[model samples]
Target chain A: MNKRELAKRVAEKCGQSQVVSTLVINTFISCILESLEAGEKITIQDFGTLSVKQQKKRERFNLATNKVETYLPYDYIKFTASKSVKIKQKEKSVKKE
Target chain B: MNKRELAKRVAEKCGQSQVVSTLVINTFISCILESLEAGEKITIQDFGTLSVKQQKKRERFNLATNKVETYLPYDYIKFTASKSVKIKQKEKSVKKE
Candidate 1:
């Protein structure tokens, strides 16, 4: 399902209009991205944990060039699904402090 | 940040009460988890794309046991960040079909 369909579901569950649901979801997305970009870890209850991991600079052989290439460090997204994930868990939301 | 803190930020941004905001955010999380569990790919505009990827069975050498172990296939979550992820882009919501 896409965002619109997801928004509709959320709106129905929360008894809110789609517009408002979408707005709140948008804000949430922004917050998550901002937090992750700052190298912060976020753990939601039913959902898994999300964090940014960095890779160290490494050297690899370039087959095409037949030369050793050094790759600079980079950041990537990592998600760990909650071990307790279940249909029943859907009612439960993000993990709390 | 934890869920409560995230909810507070979302509430402030959407001008919704903390209760309503939390409810909406919870619903959204549930929807996302359900979709992902069902092997659906979800892409939010400013955020990123999420999908379930299957890992093929593989063999790995166990140094402790000094033996080769076979691993079964499994599904894992994958998130790909958007190309246009920016602070300003947060204003935009999920990607549209």
Candidate 2:
């Protein structure tokens, strides 16, 4: 589902106005963005974990030109779903099959 | 940050009561869970995308016993952060260095 649909559902489930729900959802998104930007990880239990994983700097050679280049180290966010969620996902596939 | 802390921040940012915010947060979690359970993907733009990725079934060998075992195909959720967030994270690293 997309953000609008998801926001609508959240508003209904929480009995909040859509406008307010939109703000809350956006705030939550910004909060996560800020956290990751500050080098902190956000862990919402049973949902999943969002954290930045480090990528090492290294040198790579171009196969075609036979030239070497250096790459800088960086970090990227990684998400790992909880085991319960994983099981639920698998159960759906099993039922379909 | 953990759930409680994140919830508090969300509540403050949205100017919602903590009790209600908790419900909203939990509901959002359940919404995502239900979506994935039904084999649907949840895409929250700017923050990241959450979707199920498939893994192919394969056979693996036990190095010690030399016994082969079959593994069933399955799906798992994956998250990809937005480019803006990636840039923000990198900025923090640059500042620290």
Candidate 3:
């Protein structure tokens, strides 16, 4: 589902208006982005953990040009779903087959 | 940061009470988890995309036991950060070096 639909559902679940729900949702997203940008890890109960992982600078060969290039290191967000969620996923797969 | 801290920040940003903010945050997480469990993808603008990925059933060797084992297929949540977030990460790395 998209953001709008998700917001609607959240609003209903929280007994709030759509506009307020949207604002809350937006704030939630910004909070996560800000935390990651600041190199902080975020852990939501029953959801998972989100953190930034840095990759080291590396050299790679260009097959076509036969040249070596250096790629700068960068960071990326890593998310690990909660064990309950993982178990639920496994159960769903088992049911499907 | 943990869920309580996140909710506090969100509450302050959205000018809502801590109780309501916590409720909204909980609902938001539940929404994503439910969507993934239902095999739906959730995309939040400027944040990232969350989807469930299914792994095919396969065979693996148990090194200690030295026996072949059949592993059942399972599903996992995959999150891809937004382009802006990626660019920001690269810039942060550049500054550090």
TM-score of the first chain alone, every candidate: 0.80, 0.80, 0.83
| TM-score for all models, in order of appearance | 0.80, 0.86, 0.87
What is the alpha-carbon lDDT for the whole of candidate 1?
0.78
Distance from true position, residue B43, model 2, in Å? 2.0
- lDDT by residue for model 3 (A13-68), tens: 98999998899889988988888777788998788999988888899999988999
User: Model 2 over residues B1-97: C-alpha lDDT tens digits?
Assistant: 9988988999998898788678777888888777877778787888777877777778999898899987887888878776656534654555334
Q: TM-score for model 1?
A: 0.80
Tens-digit per-residue lDDT, A1-97, candidate 1: 7788899999998799999899999889888888886768889886778877766678999999999998865566677777776422222232333
In model 2, pairs of residues that clash are none
C-alpha lDDT of residue A94 in model 1: 29
**Candidate 1 residue-wise lDDT, B1-97, digit = tens:** 8899999998998798999889899999888888877667888776778777766678999999999998865666777777786422222222233
- Between candidates 1 and 3, the one scoring higher on TM-score is 3
CAPRI-style quality class for the chain A–B interface of candidate 2: medium
What are the candidates' individual DockQ scores? 0.34, 0.61, 0.60
Which has the higher lDDT value, candidate number 2 or candidate number 3? 3
Q: What is the TM-score, restricted to chain A, for candidate 2? A: 0.80
Q: Score candidate 3 by DockQ.
A: 0.60
Ranking 1 against 2 by DockQ, winner: 2
Top candidate by lDDT: 3
lDDT of each: 0.78, 0.79, 0.84
